[model samples]
Target: MKPRIIMNFALIITLYSALTFYIGWNGWIWLHTAFGLQDKWIFGVILELISFSYIIGHFLKGIPFFKVIGAYWFGLLQYAILFLPLANLIALVLIYLNLPTTTIVKWVGAFVLAAFIVLFLYGSFNAYSPVVRKYSLAIPKNAGKLTKLRIAMASDMHFGRLSGISHARRLVREVNALKPDLILMPGDIIDDDPEPFIQKNFGDVMKDLSAPLGVFGVLGNHEYYGGGIPRYLTEMNRIGITILLDQVTNIADSFYLVGRKDKTDRDRMPIEDLLMNTEINLPIIMMDHQPAELKQAEKNHVDLLLSGHTHRGQMAPNHLITKRMFEVDWGYLKKNQLHTIVSSGFGFWGPPLRIGSRSEIIQIDVTFV
Candidate 1:
């Protein structure tokens, strides 16, 4: 790249980063106001977010020795951003309602929030990587009969500098350990741009995956956002994972996996056609990037549906709002015999911060009794 061009790109990046931070702080202020809203509890949280925000500015710049301090500061920042002004409003309302916090209670609340700030940051960023959990579900006798099945699920790999080969290796190491019948990556393996990351890391890590039933993936909203669907789809294909674009594939003889294009995609698959022959009754698992279209999964009588897009709000109180943002926030939910599991995701995305929720990869075991 030319020197002038390189300088220009850096300038653009700086501007974009500034915009992101501003939006994050602003959104969080309102988010905290909307939630985290207890008396005194909210008051302590607001102060911390400010300190941490400053820390983040330092860390991103490679300000040596400031990293750990930044970590703590960033955590407190999260708390404050989500706690203070919101608590003030709640307190005012309480006062009007003839309820006021006692002095001792206020002191205790402050102490607790201070502690919470420390813990949240440790868990969110400084903490060691989490072990992925494997789950087993027995075939319900009421269903009349069953067949053996297992699926591995992971999402939100992000695939940027923060989540490169080493991270992918750690994750694939876990995936191999599960010995799942099939591996499924629902979406967001690459945060926004899949090209650079795919060229950098995915080819090496994904090529070595151990699952015999094969690996399949679908487009996430970011896949659409970074470039058009074609380039991302082509890139994921080059890495060897099949892109299931609003289509069904019979992984094994007894079950079918239907993968839908992201709903936000202009060219999302017509779901009804994918569900052709509902009478077949073979166990069916559907994979779509976002959990937004859950009704279709239920209406199709899909035995199981898997998705990840919410990132479980990634930070505190954000998940609370995330629930309001989408019908499914995270984890397992059952509706009439159909099961949907949304993975909080395997890696962090933009902020590299996860306040309220932990990242996760899901291993599921299915069996016939």
Candidate 2:
């Protein structure tokens, strides 16, 4: 590499390393602060170092969205960060000098600023993740055939302390409130090893979820990496979300819900088998995580497909990548024989930072005349 280019590459690596560590460790810091953790001095911190391996693995797998974020906003964020440490020091000094000021007022100001930052980040990520993303279609209704088909869609539940029981119950309640005849979980149900929560009372949190027809989920790329597919599958089964691996199912006597495995699966998804099994007369709806398989979905004349892997690129300016990589990025679109709706999702997986995409639950109302 040329001298300047080499230096720039070095600088980029340094930044990536620093931020990944911070992202990894921030969870540890929160755990300590939240419950007054009394473990080994460095237990949480060590886990942070280990978690960076996933960062390295993600880069190896060619996560392209980060490049997009760097191209657009890295310059501005870097500029802000240059002054951030100094700003913190200056604030501390001011607080110390104004010791006569009320401690309550200062503490309240600090908390208010922190809450604003959290809210700002959350709202910026706001995409329409409706528990019922309503839509209409015309199908023939028999004397006693299925009239209205309901679909409940959810994604990106990180499943740590924050994403545990309470979060799942609330989202599931929101979804069940729509009374979906069918349910779909696109991917990333349990962010990492759901084992910690699953073993405790947390697993019961998901049991309250009920769908008249059934609930099905696919392996997100995270499930494969975090602890392996079977581990995630075990947890889901315990909670009763059926695992669909390159499988297709007929829904409500008119439509087909075919869930393809995540693109990360090297075993080769049996798209042809799925098509062969389903009735050609009925409209087909597919659930594939990446939205990377447009040609096949188009060729198959699928009526609609739902996915949530993009999280609308999961961060700001990065959502542009979802547009570039897939014909449909993070919302509803149709072409040729395909109608696809991509949900930005209901939970944050990594940094608790959602910049460009809204956290959501998608509801698609399928109808027969």
Q: What shift in Å separates residue 21 of candidate 2 from its native position after superposition? A: 13
Off by over 4 Å in 1: 1-80, 83-121, 124-128, 139-146, 277-279
Candidate 2's displacement at residue 151, Å, is 1.0
- Quote the positional error of residue 142 for candidate 1 in Å: 13
Q: Candidate 1 on 166-186: residue-level lDDT in tens?
A: 778877888888887789999
Candidate 2, superposed: residue stretches over 4 Å from native: 1-12, 15-132, 138-144
lDDT of 2 by residue, 1-369 (tens): 699999998998798767645433433444445545567457745644443444443454344344234322332343234434454455467668875334533443455347546744554435223334555554343313676777778876766543456566678789878887777888877765555456555557776678888888877777766665676677678878788888887665766778787888788465766788676667777888777877778787677778887777766667776778877778787775567788877876554456666677777776655
- For candidate 1, report its TM-score: 0.68
RMSD of each: 10.2, 9.4
Error of 1 at 54 (Å): 15
